[model samples]
Target: MIKVDNLSFSFPQKELFNNISFTLEEAQHCAFIGTSGSGKSTLIDILMDPERYLFDGKLEMDPDCTIGYVSQFSELDNTKETTVFEYIGEPFIKLQNEIQSICTEMETSTDIEPLLEKYQFALDALDAIGGDDFESNIHKQLNVANLMKRRDSKVADLSGGEFKLIQVMKEMLNRPDILIMDEPDVFLDFENLNALKKLIHSYKGILLVVTHNRYLLNHCFNKIIHLENREIQEFDGRYIEYNFSLLQTKMELQELAVAEQEEMERNDTIINNLRVIATYNSDASRGRALKARVRFQERLEARRIKAPFVEIKQPNISFGVDNEMEDAIVVSVHHYSVGFDELLLDNVNFEIKSTDKVAIIGANGTGKTTLLRDIFKNNHASIEINADVKVAYLSQLQGEMLKDANTILEEFIDAGFKTYDEIGLYLFNYGFEGETLSQKIESLSGGEKNLLQLAKVSASKANVLLLDEPTSHLDTYTQLALEKAIEKFKGAILMVSHDFYSVVNGMDYVLIIDDKTIRKMTLPKFRQMIYDSHFDKDYLETEQKKKSVEMKIELALKNTDFELAKGLVEELEELIKWL
Candidate 1:
């Protein structure tokens, strides 16, 4: 258990939090929710005692408590030659040494022998924690993060998502009483996300998580703590309740602000009238009038006016001519196979017709993006295609494309767009206006760059669009706006995405790729396939029984029945083995 009392923090140019207070009891799970740049990460950093930050508060914890933190970014030594088993087992190695020391210091007895048995017991525990299958777990994490298959590969060969998952798995293996994870679900696929949820549910500790994923937050968080306007506020219940409560609070604040402004205006008018009359009256009357005016000013200053909340505006994309083409195949992949060593995609054949919206779906690392790139390359290679079939490609991190540019307008001009007015209009539609449009591209954030890229694509006269993970960095509202835009587009679209909600809502056709093959299906059929594949009768029954047993054991342990708890633990172990 831990408590933070009257905590305040600020950076050089901005105040992050002021007089924030919160508590995390034993086994409690809390989530920090806020918009981007609201200082969630800074608060976490202060709690974790990271250098280069200042803290002005009291953080009280149980003297024996141990903390384990998983950062958003992972730092792995590329040259260490450490296998996954050794990597996760490193934490237990220290425990094993301590156990050995205790055994050596104690006299020989039955108790000593039982206690000494813990060294070997710890080894078995490590294996049961998946140490023996550590390599497999690492592969699973990497694959779920969409990294290529490279079991013996160095960490340097991994992408940002891959490294982040590896760091998370490492922290989980430590089994600390206080776990702080920052955005664990950011790069994971559905399968791995479920695995992480199961693991967190099974954990017996205090969990403080920071994430933007609504699904994970809704499922795992028991309470939400929001940081806004240099203050912290707590909301009870799941994400849905918290969101609703937040909206209600914002509306109330806005109403109060309107009332305060009206009062201030009324006071200003009275003060003005008093001043006008006092000028023609005696000195005593003038002095009283000036005093009244000062009091009114003080009252106005005392009124707590909430700062206006700025909402990011959605883009208005107008699709040009809806000239449906019967023979226009925007993209075609014929007998295509791609891999680093082994085949990831094989004999993949697909064709995109004009006005068709196709969603490429697969388990992570199944070469969805590779397939898109192949299609783009093939389209570029074709010489017989018409000149009017203009294509625009949006990569996963499209912002990186503008790193060298001085300004967004300059980048747009360099990208061969004609007019600044047209570019400004497009930027405004994507939530960038006036000063933002003139901002240097090198100084823009990831989300800002993403908006700029979308604006550029919308301004282009391209009829065929290729988007890879377009919605990954976007918020829920922006994603919905993009879905609407895609629906309005008259051109063909080839997109690869893992966001299930967007896939279900926006995609017209689904292409499932696996083991170097592609299978085409309608959206309805794809949903059914995924559901039926994951929730077969046998698996459902097993999962139900597993949950029942876990609940029973938890209830028994709550009553301080040690013998029953020990027995239940053993039974649970056996059940896990069976599973």
Candidate 2:
């Protein structure tokens, strides 16, 4: 259990949290969420090591609690040459190795009693970590993550997403009392994402996960801790219920705001009348009345509603084309194959028309990003891009498009922005302010870096866009904005995405990469396949109905129809139970 009281933290440039307090108790799975650059990860850091920060807060942890953590930006060192099984079994392996060494010492030394005691201690340590069937347990965790095939593979050889799941497996198998994972779902393909959901659900200990994946958000957490507007809002319920509570608050706040506006307008009219009377007659009573009316208006203004969560800013992302391609195929890949040690994709072929928006989707390490990179490079013998097409590429690796050594302002200038003023104005739409422009790119949060990448891509003015996992680090609001922008892009788009909503809501069709070959699937078939593979058809159907009713309730609330809204809330409460 962890508890924080009256916490306030800030960087030199800005305040990140103000008077925020929340308690994470036993058996609670809390989703930590907020807008981009809102200090979710920073808070995690403070919790992990309170001494590293200088802040005003009371952070308490139970003395008996054991904690495990998985950071957002973690990587497997390729130079170490560790395999997946060995990595997950590290604790057990160390203990087992010590036990073997103690037994060997017993064979050579006259102090056999001490060596026997040491061997027993090592065996006890191994048992303490549930290492009785360590190898099989490792396999079980890998199977849970859908990475059983990679059990024998080198950890360095796995893709970024796969390695991330391995980290999760390692941490979860350690069986700490409390596990804190920061954005663990980032870069995960759909199946791996599902695997993460299962792992979180199956975890018995306390959990505090920072994630923006809606599927995980909807399915995994039992509690919600939202950090926004320099404050924390904690809810003791599921994410869906928390969201409904937010919507209800928004509805009531909107009504209060409207009434407040009307009252202010009427008070303004009264003040104007009193002013007129005071101006016409030099009566002391008239002047006093006008002063009273003005004071009333000021009080009303102070009481006006500015609801949180309802007014969160979303990045303004719009993709544009530099030149039209005259209705031709903008990109074409034929007989393409790419891999290092093996053929991940063999004789794959796909094409994107001048205005087509297609998604490239597959399991992790199945060559989705590789294929996109090949198309963008246009160097392979089988890859052909139209001569007239101008291409812009967004890499999943943010470093590919950004220089860590440069400031935000410098990066844009290097990217061809004319002046600081222009860059400032442009970056403002993407949520970077004038002061933040001077910060080094390396200092930004993962979501902030992704926003910078999107801002760069939008300004490229290319007829062909090759985006690899563009929504990986973005928050939900930013992700929705990007989806809208992708929907309206007037050019060829070959997007590699694992977001089901992004693909279903924006793309025209999907190019499936399976079994080392590429094929196209219509949107309808893709939707059905997703429902079949990841979710229950009945559950999704109920979810759809729930969404429809929620919208109706919003409409009712907007119209100030309390009776209708009340009825819909009852209906939704019943639906929530089923979900």
Candidate 3:
């Protein structure tokens, strides 16, 4: 459990938040929701003591409780060769050593036999907590984070998603009583998001998660704490309830300010009349009335003014005319296989018609990105032909494109875009303004980087767009705005996104890339497929049977029934092979 009392923080010229007070009881999950630059990440940094931002607060915690924090970026030391298991298990090594020391000290005493037994008991307790199933826990964490296959891969070779997941796994393995996560769902797909939800549901600890994904917040959190106008307020329901509460509060405050202004005007008129009467009659009574009127004026001046209203603005994009189509193909892949020696797509044949809006969907690592890359490479190879189409690819980890040496405005210019005034106007549409446009790209957050990528793509005037996980870090409002832009685009679109809402609500056709093949379906049919696939009894029954066999073997081993466990394992192996 944790509590914050009288917390206030301010920057050089502005207060970020003030008088913030809240209590997070054990096992309670809470989410922080706000617009960009609204101090969501700043609050997390203050809690975690990362940047020592100015603050006056008392953060009280249980004496023995531990806190684990996961950042948006993973900063593992790449110079050292470390395995996934070692990385996860590193947290417990200190406890393991302490247990060893206790045992050694008790071993040399004859009169300390009971003490030795106590130390043995303590060691067993620690092992039971995390040591016994450490390996399995690592696997489960990696699986939940969608980094299972990359366990043996080096940290340097991981995709952005895999790296972020590893950070999550490392924090989970620490088994702290309180977990503070910033943008925990940055690169996760649907399957991994569900897995993370289930894991959080099962956790018996406190979670303070900051994320822009509404689905994750709606599914995982019961409390929503909003930061607005340099203050914090807690809502006791889901994200929708919190959002409605904020709207109502804002409306009430606006009405109150109006009434207050009217009252002030009325008081001013009464004071003016009293002053005129006192001017007409100079006496003790007149002096007393004047003093009383001045007191009212002072009281009026002491009242705090309501904070100004600020609304988050989104990017406005108007795509140009669609390019003319010719006899030559825009995109074609023939017998293409891509991956690290493993074929993700095999003998795949696909073509993109001019001005086609294609949605790529699959489980994580099923070659959606590979297909996009193939298209871009194919298009680049045919650039000499007049019929060849221009392709622009937007990656999920667009943050990597930002350089410290260039401001966002400079980066736009460096990317060969003309018209500084036009670029500044475009950036303003995407929420960048004045000082923000002058800020280095490296100073921007993940969400800001995503906006920059959108700006760059829009300015390029490319005939084809290849976007991979474009909505991964975007908030719902921004995602909807981007979806609108995509819908208005007249050129060819080949996008790979795991945001199911975007696919179902935006794209015309869904392309399921799996089992080394690309299967195309319409958005309506794909939604039906998702529905039927989940609710079908026969399918559920088959999956249940498979899980049943695995559970039986696990139970047998736990009970020390070797013969039965071996038989069950063999049967499970046979079933797996047949499948």
Candidate 4:
């Protein structure tokens, strides 16, 4: 069991957690969930680095038991240029090194028995962690994860989803006593996500996940460790039940708090009335009544309830409609093809009529972003569109595009937005203010840059949108705001996204990119296709590029580095010009 008692932690400005306590026993799976900056990540980091953080706590953990971690956005240390096989067999690699050292020691002395004992211990350790048959077990694990096919691939070159899968596989290869996953749902598509779910379910070790995905929280975890009001709240069951209980608790609190507030207000009013009457009467006997009323007001104030603030500030997003255009098909692609050195799709045909919301989805590196770029580049190509179709592209490369640009004030002014205060007010609505409005564009974090880019794109008066991974880095509340903003938009949107929650509920139709073919399928059809392993090996295959220029373009645009974007966009135009 991993026991935590009487834990409290503080930063320079605020006390993050107070008297927090929890435990994870064998066979118990729980999750730590809270609002943004509530120390969910900090708590996990402290767990991994017990020697570093100084806090008041009593932690009881078995010395021999091993702990494994999967970071939310952390990448593997690929400094050694590791391969998939080597990365997955890292534990065995360490074991073999130890065994070799013991054998070398045997060569110098007449201690054969000791060497043999050491060797046997190492082998037994491996068997105990994974399985008895070493080679067979390795093959089975790798095969199940689909890493065997890419066994020789460099670990550094792996896609985010692929890297996450391999990371999980490595932990599973040497089953730790406790496994902690921090936001495992971030970059995963439908295919990789299901595989992870299966692996988690089948693992015998205790599991703890920190995620904002409600679907994942409900399906994977059995317990909820909620961080709220600087206190740790524990629930014995899954999220749905805990949510219902939390709702009831809040309702009870609201009733008590409201009653307290009402009583205090009534008492204050009585005092005011007594003072007014005493002033008018000018009688010495009125002093007693005034004093009594003041005493009652003091008593009410002394017993006032301090109610918890339950509201989380979400971004206020509004995408106004450019009704200048007539209602007609905004975008039409016919007999078009898109790819680089490798072909991803061929003779694809699709139409965005009026204000359709189309989601482009496929496995990782399967031309979703490329398809968006293709549609965007066709502004100068043969792709037909209504004369009034004003297309605004939100590339993943927007950050790179705007990286070297001037301050937010300059960018806003350059974009034709008049007045610094006007831009400040506009940005303030999206969570930026006075000094922040004058801050340099590059100074913002990746997520902040993403939000700013989102604000810029949604602010456009364009009648059509071509967005790629716009919600990948946004917080849940911001994502909800974006969804509402999209709902408010009267323009056509063709977005490339792996955010299943947003795509599943927000988009009207899905454009599935598979096997060099494009199919406009219903949302249910696309979900069913990815949910089950119905397709063969050759079907969902992808050829990942050395570096995705598309992402660079999006980032550059966000960074306002238009000089870099121009060349990159031109190169992108040249490469995908082939059938």
Candidate 5:
């Protein structure tokens, strides 16, 4: 129901999109993906309100279409005393209040005709939203989100992640023609994430979600709109298939580029020989041959392979250590209990050995962030840290750790960088450039802020890192890079995260908090727990075979063996059928 044509947008320092176009139709779920700070969120804002910006584009949307949006950093007003049920039914409540006001006015006003018309319109709007049964619908949604117990709880009292999900529920129940969610899965626990997945899958209207969560990307989207290098690539398939196609194309391009290079080298040698002969003998034909070869070289250069996808840039993230601990427990917590109004964690014990990578996992409101904060502070009597260990922390609430009023350069300067050149040089590795360094941290996107946090962590030279939801606002490429960095780090790590792929791939083991206590679980058991709780019975096996076929197909195509590639395609098709 929406279309963008020849759209181009840029800031003063950088061009975000150039002549990019895509269409969103009814019942289509589109995943908007790109590199960190690639303007995915900016483009969504433009789509929501084209009149708000001066840009070159044609945004054609159905006039009757109503849009529901959930932004990445949205939060509830803490002073407002609204219950979860009332919050989700605000639209319904508003319409009902209008109708009641009109009825009351009709009894006292001389102009009853206008009041009658207004009352009729309000009734129609309320009926359209099913205001009659909105209470029941709200209950059902709360139950689906596993928040039935908190239906009467104040929304402001809910945790950040829970509040985000409630916002989503509010928008969904409004039943707009289009729904756009930016990083809705961020900070969500596993159960809440599962609820979001189900909601996206069951949404009947057009959906445009910006997320880097691998689970959501794999399970929710039917189309992928990838923005990279000021260009857009639209894939009309699942993300898995889209990713495999990109890999296959990269392989083919690389193979063809190599062949072209060899041909160009041969032409260069022939041209040189012809020139040498002409210089020695003054032969006219020799000169003509050299001229013809030069023209051929120009043509080859014009048609050379350009693989933008293959050259997609990811941030160079590396965590440094000043002094690596040797075979000792870097952090130890014994009989640790932390909570505010109620007991969340009671006498939980966990330890991180030197060079060990551990993940602390639990449900929402189970004191995961609280425990991490306690460790970072190292102030509790039950917590112990090695005297020689240094620490760095990446908070899930990036804004809390970052000064909002400070510019990027100023933030770094305050963080202990001595000179402008040093700060610029260091920030460049995290994708911050010269002009962007002058921008305030509050003006930056969520992903950009997270990258800034990572840069700070890397520069700390700490032997132990406490990372909480590090992959939340990062792009897929950055997330992969972080996994690599985590794998290569030379110190002990304790992370609190809900990202399944990051936890499974990067962490050595898991410390699961359950029933107010801590329990250690091996990676194998953790993997099985995820599969049993969320995935299909044969998903793991099917994914392995699919990956194998995809690689085989890439190789076959690169070698110009069409028959082998076709056979591999058939095998992949069969695997997809089972999926």
Candidate 6:
């Protein structure tokens, strides 16, 4: 059990949490959902500290309660010569040392009674924390994470995704009172994410996760906590329900404010008319009417509500395609075998058309990135490209674009991918405000940088896109923006992504890359093989409605018809009743 009261935190320039409070009972599964840079991760870190109450808040847990945290940014220490097995049992090893030292000192010490009591307490604590079965638990978790074969593997030799899985499994083996995971699904392929999702559902303790993975949040979490605009909100259900509530509340609140303002304005006009009449001739009736009107205006002023930040929010984004782009096969690969030391995948054959939406999916280390690299190198004879066709690639980090000399707005202008008006359009879609124009490009968050990269490529004359994990660090809202952009674009798309939801909605064809093998199939069969039922009727219909409204809004904004855009956005909000 845990309780937080009036918790507040501040960064150097940004004030993150302001008097936030919440409680988590034992066995309650909750998720902290927020956009990028919303301080959700920072809050989890603060929760791990025993002295967290020193920072203007009170964090209380039942005495002797232990907390286990697996940080998203934690990396294994490669300098240390430790194996996965040894790392998983570190907590148990420390407990063993404490008990050993106590017993050894008790054998020859004069204070035998107190030493004996200390020894007994140590043993009790060990049993309480499941120290006796630590090794067995470690092996069990390894099997679940599909790392049993690598139990003896060195931490330094593991890939990033493998290291992440191991760190999480290690914590699960520790069996603390409360478990916290911050974006544990980040950088994980679909296979590993499925395992993690199952593990979270089976966790018996208090579970608190900070993640933007829509599938994980919706399927594994029973409660939702949202952070925005320096305030915290609690919802009884999952992300979809919370999102609907948020949108509906904003719409209703805006409606009230608009009506109240109109009433106030009309009342002012009446008061001014009475005042003019009173100034001409001070009749008793005129004076009385003016006084009543003034009092009424004061009452309206006292009760008026101002508009909120939600009204200023916009979903404007674009990925430009060549206006003259024609529908034809852009590239064709046949019997492709790519490898250096050993072949990763072979017999990979697929055709990408000018309007095709394809997804490249596979487990970790299964040659997804290698295939992309081979295409980039253009040294393989098994691949063929259409003549006079242009292509562009968006890598994992898009680091090169983020580090450019231009500002966020300047990058698009310099690349000539979009007009000045459309250059700033994506900033708003990615949730960046006008203030971002003056900031350096490197100062943007991962999601913002991803959007900027897409903007740059959209402006090019390329009709084919080869993207590697384009949704890597993006939050759910931005991912939705991406999904809409993908649907509207006329060019062909071939992307390798770890996000299964994005792949399911964004792609029509699926390519499987496995251990030295390649197979092409349709998206529906791939989803069915994975036992996916996430795309139910209600969800799809609501999503289609949202997409249609968004597309209309984007077109109106592009035409610079703000009035039509405003009205359509209001209609979009009204549709939240079905969300």
* C-alpha local distance difference test of each model: 0.66, 0.88, 0.70, 0.73, 0.88, 0.75
- Which pairs of residues have clashing backbones in candidate 2? none
* TM-score, per-candidate, Cα-based: 0.66, 0.94, 0.72, 0.76, 0.94, 0.76
Which structure is stronger by TM-score: 3 or 5?
Answer: 5
List clashing residue pairs in candidate 5. Answer: none
Task: Give the C-alpha lDDT of model 1.
Answer: 0.66
lDDT for each residue of candidate 4 in 1-579, tens digit (9 for 90 to 100): 788898999876557888889888888788777654567777887777778888997877888878898876666565658888888887787887887798788898786887888889987886776544545656676677666787878887677788898888777777788899887766677777766766677677788887766456656777888875678878888765665455344445555666788887887888788788887797877888888878877877787555333444677887776664556888888877766667777888888887789998888767777778767776625477777777778777655446546787787777778888778888887877656676688655445667777777766777788888877546566787888888778778998887776787678999887787778889877655654463334322210120266567657755656667667755554433320
Number of clashing pairs, model 6? 1
Model 1 spans with C-alpha error above 4 angstroms: 1-21, 54-66, 75-81, 94-166, 228-231, 246-327, 378-386, 397-400, 404-449, 531-579
Of 2 and 3, the candidate ahead on TM-score is 2
Question: How many clashes (backbone N, Cα, C below 3 Å) per candidate?
Answer: 1, 0, 0, 29, 0, 1
Best by lDDT: 5
Cα lDDT tens digits, model 6, 91-111, are 788889999999889888997
Model 4 weakest 10-residue run by lDDT: 538-547
Clash pairs (backbone) in predicted model 1: 346-516
Off by over 4 Å in 3: 5-15, 18-21, 62-64, 75-87, 101-170, 228-231, 244-312, 321-329, 377-388, 417-421, 532-579
Q: Which tens-of-lDDT digit does each residue in 1-579 have in candidate 1?
A: 878899888755456788889888876778876554457777777767635566788878777676788865445576777654445446656556665666675655556676667657767666545555655665555454344254455655554445555566667656667889876665566665665665566566788887766557656777777766677777666765555444334445555666678888888888887788777876796778778777977977787765423233445654444244565776666667678856787777777777788888876667887767656655433212334577777777564456545688889888777898977876676666675567677655444566566766776657888788776545455666778888888888888876666677678988887556988989878766655754444543454465576666556645545456557655655544443
Count: clashes, candidate 4: 29
Residue 116 CA error for candidate 3 (Å)?
Answer: 7.6
Model 5 whole-model lDDT (C-alpha atoms): 0.88
Question: How far out, in Å, is residue 387 in model 3?
Answer: 2.8
Clashing residue pairs found in predicted model 6: 417-459
lDDT of 2 by residue, 18-98 (tens): 989999988999999999899998899898888899989799987767789998889769897888889999998988888
